[model samples]
Target: MTAVADLFNLKGQTALITGGSSGLGLQIAEALGTQGARVVISARKADVLESAQAHLAGLDVDASWIAADNAREDHVERLANDAMERLGKIDILVNNAGATWGAATADHPLSAWDKVMNLNVRAIFLLTQQIGRLSMIPNRYGRVINVASIAGLKGNGPTSQPTIAYNTSKGAVVNFTRALAGEWGKYGITVNALAPGFFPSKMTRGMIEKVGIEKLAERAPLQRIGDDDDLKGAALLFASDAGKHITGQILAVDGGVTAV
Candidate 1:
C-alpha cells in the first residue's frame, strides 16, 4: 500500500519545466508542486520566472527558477548545469517552451522557420539530450512530456494564421515523442507529447476568435474550448509512476477536436 501510494505521489522527485514561468507551463508547475515534487521552472524572462517562483512557493512545493533562452545552444548548457547544481537530479522533464507565428508558407521567412524550429523542435531535442546524458539515463529512470498543439493535428482556419513552420515543428514534436519513447523505454525512461487543442494563452486566441469559438465548439464533438482544469489529469497520468507502463504515446487534450 505504501509503495502504491509512493508511485502516485511525487515526493522526493525533482522536475524541470521549460517555459514554466507562465501560462500552461506555470499551471503544470503549480500542480506538480502541490502534489509534492520539487520543481525547477525556466523561461527567457527573469522577472516572469521570479513571479512564477513566488506562485510555486505559495503552493508549498520546493522550487527554483532559471532564465534561459531555449533557442540558444549556450543557454541549454547553462540551463542544464544550473539545474543539476541546484536540483542535483531531474527525475522528470517537461519541454513546454515553444515558439509560433502565423504566416503562409510562401510568405514565411527562412529566419522565421529557423527560429520556430530551433525553439520548438531543436531545443526540445537538445534539452532532452543534455538532461538525459547528464542525469536521467545514467539513473535509468525518467519521465519527459513535450507540449505540442492540435494545430499539429489539423489546419486551423483557412487564413487565420498559416504558420507553416509552426505546424511543421509541432508535427516534428509529435513524432519525436514516439521515436524517443521507443529508444528510451528499455532504459526505464518514458517520452511522450501532449497535444492541446484550443486553449487561450499567449498563443491561439487570435485564431480562435477569427475562427469563431462557437463554430469551433460545434465542430469539436466536445462542444467547448479547453480549460485549465482539463489539463491536470492527463498530465498527472503521464508524469506519475502510474504512467510507468506507458510510453511513445501522444495524448490529445483537444476537447474531441481531433476526433472529428
Candidate 2:
C-alpha cells in the first residue's frame, strides 16, 4: 500500500469507544468506522447505545453497542471480553466516559468530587490497565485515547465555569496518558490524549444554551468552537499507522484556545 493510503486506513481493525453513545465519542467512532474499522460503542445506558448503533448503521459501518458502566469495576473487563468475543481483537480504545459537576472552588461537595474522579480518572486507569494486560500488552499493539479538556490544561475561572474537581481529574488524565505511554511504548501501545475546548454536546449543553455556542467559539483564537471534523484527523493519526512512533502526547482540539 502507498504510504498515505495505509497511513490513515483502519481497515481490518476493531475499535471500542467508551461513552460512545453520544458527543465526541460518537464522532470518533464515525471517523474510525468510515475508515473501515469495525466499531463497538459502549455506555451505561442501553437505550442510548442502541440509538448510537442505529446512527452508525446508516454509515454502512460494522457497528454494535454494549451497555456498560465504565465507572463499575467489572464492566471494564467485560467490555474488552465482549469486544474480543465478537470482533476478534481490539486495536483502539477511547476512554471517553467522564462525569462533571460544577460548584465553586470553596463549596464543592466531596461526594461530587468522588463521583467525577472515579469515572474520569480512576475508571480510566483501571480500565486501561485491564485492557492493556489482557489484550494490548499481550498482542503488543494498541491505541489508547483519553478525552481531556482545556480545563485540564489550565484553570477555568468561576465567572466562566467552576468545576475544580473536573479540571483536576482531567489534569490527572493528561499526566496519566504521558506516564502510561512511556511505560507501554516498548510494548507497542501508544497512549495519547485529546484536549478539546468548547463544543456542542450533552456535556456542554448547559454552557452552550446559556452563553450561546457562537460566543464560546469566539473565545478561541480561531474565533470558532470545535466541531465534529476537528477530531477526525487528530484521532485518526494516533490510531492509524501514521502515528506508530508518536506517543506520550496530548493533542489539543481547542481551536487555539490553549495557545491563548
* lDDT (Cα, 0-100) at 183 in candidate 2: 95
Query: Candidate 1 overall Cα lDDT vs. reference?
Result: 0.87
Top candidate when judged by TM-score against the true structure: 2
Give a tens-digit lDDT track for model 2, residues 1-260: 56888889999988989989999999999999999999999999999888899999999889999898878888887887888888877889998999899889789999999999999998998888877877899999999999988789998854687899999999999999999999999999999999988877898898888899778877889899988788888889989999988999998888898887
Q: Write the per-residue lDDT of candidate 1 for residues 1-260, one digit (tens) a residue.
A: 44766677888889999999977898788777877889999999999988889877887878899999999999999999999999999988999999898777788899988999999999999999999998999999999999988877777677456778988899999999999999998889999888988777777677676777787677668799877677777777788988888899998998887886
* Regions of candidate 1 where Cα sits further than 4 Å from its true position: 1-6, 157-160, 208-216
Model 2 weakest lDDT span, ten residues long: 155-164
Q: What is the C-alpha lDDT of each candidate?
A: 0.87, 0.89
